[model samples]
Target: MPKVLDCLVNVHFGEREQPAWMLEVRDKYFKGPQSMYRQVDLAELIDEMDEQGVEKAILMYSIVKPSPTALKFVEEMPDRFALAVNGVDLLHPVSSLRELAALVHDLPVAYTTVGPSFWGDGMYPPTDAVYYPLYYKCAELGLPLCMNTGLPGPPIPGEVQNPIHLDRVCYRFPELKLCMIHGADPWWDVAIRLLIKYENLRLMTSAWSPKRLPDSLLHYMRTRGRDKVIFGSDWPVLPMRRLVPEALALDLPDDVRDNYLYRNAQEFFFGGRSAGGTAE
Candidate 1:
């Protein structure tokens, strides 16, 4: 098996039950039994990753609060896990930047994240000026930014996450490394165009099954877009044990699958780190 680097995995506080909202999401979107959303024991997750040949994973934080437990994982297993700050308040850019700066100063934060549609009633798209400061700060600090794109699974308005909004943001901040997760459905044509147009942008295969990845995306991965795609389980939505094997089973060239599964993420999110977790 190729060494894996999961670009997105939400590891909640160890061994605790998942929140109610997550159960609803699993029921509505994943179509899996309640066990799919069950909380994971961190040690067991590591064993699973090892059994599955996963070298490392990026733990995405909550939308409501960054998990201290998540940070503890990074602190304890610096080589196995990295943190992505996803809970920052987009409406309050200044405070968000402050919190981000503090986290970056002390933690092995791989990147900051935003879910445009999950911003409650504000529903600010990625292009909204409110997010500019975060873009500016992440770029200045050499940190990447990951945002949810396409129609979200929950009941909220999905328009806010349309991939189209990223065009302006990308153009405005060319230095920022930004990734669109959750597979930009419906607007995949637009997503492909943007991925081709922007060198600093990437698409993560999170929240979507490998067998079902769009043909257009698969073709692109096999051709000119290999380096532009990254692997992410968005675990609990899609478990690592199940998702990794399915991904490896795809009819793709070894190099292409390598890029999708780990290499691209090493370069894109890990600052050109080697697969063994050493910086180039």
Candidate 2:
């Protein structure tokens, strides 16, 4: 059986933390209620490790940049964490995609995400030439590239989170492990069908609420290839313990469930660190 892995988690310390307006939206529409994100970050990490019996995580968002935050965990417990480099928010003053590519070139980034963390532009698609090099860099690095599909409300508008927008990139960079996050939310159907058609692409369970997850996602994981699925909680957004039970309870095979939870990521990220050890 595969072990469950808390594939995603983060600690955010910024000048203005979890902005109030976005907080209001998250408080309302995010997977679980505020009750889930109520716990302190480290406490929840320890608690989830105890509750889920899982090992390893991709600790993103140790802000002020990715290297420092990721290094902290990696330096302490090397194999336990896969630190990522932060990509320039499309809305931020991203000088050029070339600059962004160069910034990540020498860093120990397992992979990175292209997103809308800034105030304006959203990473809509690869149609624009700027995103092509970004994809190329990912392919060159051979890292898992996670693209935000759909997480809306203050920060960005709802329309910007669509996954169909990824068509151009997926088509252009066939080898890139472009794992779609959040079931691509409203775009789940498009994403699922696309993955079905294109074997290289994959999906991760980032923020899908069991209560609200569409059946298409269940069918894809159940009927399609479980090996292609990855586990993610969009943590500080949805806790691992809270989300895993719902997924584990599904009718899929135990091994399939395990694969989705951690096995696949273990193989992908650590190349064989699937022994269920978080010890340094």
Candidate 3:
């Protein structure tokens, strides 16, 4: 089996420590006794990754206040994990950027994530000036800015999540690396166009099950966009056993499979350092 790097996994500190929104979302989307939303221990997560053949994963945390435990996990096991800091307060752009800088200055974080649909007023487009500072900071740090570009997990207005808003952001900040999470679904065609247009933008198949991935995305992944797409199991929302197998089972060529499964993420997060093996 090819090595894997799951680009988006959510790890709670513990059962009782999970956020209310998480429980609400779980109740809404996941039903039955076998749902993956049940509390997850860090050790259990590592075990699951090992069982699923995932060599490394990027743990995404809430922007409001990233879990200290999540940070500790990556710190303790740097080789097995990397952090993706989500939800920066764009309302206070300057100070938020400084605070974010301090947070990742010496940590094991690979990128900063923003959910345009859930952050701030929920109406500002991704290209709004409020987000420019954060983008500038990310560019300065050489860290990719990951954005949730489709319907968010929590109950929120989805209009702001449109992939079209990113055109201006990408054009304005050409040097900044952007990772569009969730495949920008429902508008993935627009995403495909953007990916083709921008060298620094990438897309990860987070949140969506592999079987549900659009045919357009699959075609792009196997051909022209091969180097621009990566794998992400939005864990707890989707189980590893289900996600890994389905993704690997796709009718993808060997080169595309290797790139999507790990190489793209390795380069995106670690500047070309493969997490499991030498980069091809």
Candidate 3, which ten residues in sequence have the lowest lDDT sum?
Answer: 30-39
Query: Over 4 Å off in model 3, which ranges?
Result: 13-21, 32-38, 276-280
Write down the TM-score of every candidate: 0.93, 0.80, 0.92
Per-residue lDDT of candidate 2, residues 1-280 (tens digit): 2466666665443213555765676766663464543424444566676677666666664223444444555566554555555554443324544554654564434556655323245544445665566576668767777766665545555555576767767787887777776667667788787778766687777766554677777777777767677887766677666777787777777777778887777665554644333322
Question: Per-residue lDDT for 1-280 in model 3, tens only?
Answer: 7889998887753534456776676677654143454556778888989998899988876557667667777878888887888767787777677777877876777888888876565788787888888888999999899888977767778878889899999999998999999878678899999999999999989888898898999999888998999899888778788989998889899899889888899988888866733454
lDDT of each candidate versus the true structure: 0.83, 0.62, 0.82
Q: Per-residue lDDT tens digits of candidate 1, residues 1-280?
A: 8989987887773446766656678777678776764566779889889987889888876546657667777878888998888777766767767878887888777888888887766367887788888888999999999889989887779998889999999999999999999899988989999999999999998988888888899999998898999999987668888889999999899999998998899998878977445867
Off by over 4 Å in 1: 13-20, 62-64, 275-277
Clashing pairs in 3: none
Best by lDDT: 1
> What value of lDDT does candidate 3 attain over all alpha carbons?
0.82
Distance from true location, Cα of 215 in model 1, Å:
0.5
Candidate order by lDDT, decreasing, is: 1, 3, 2
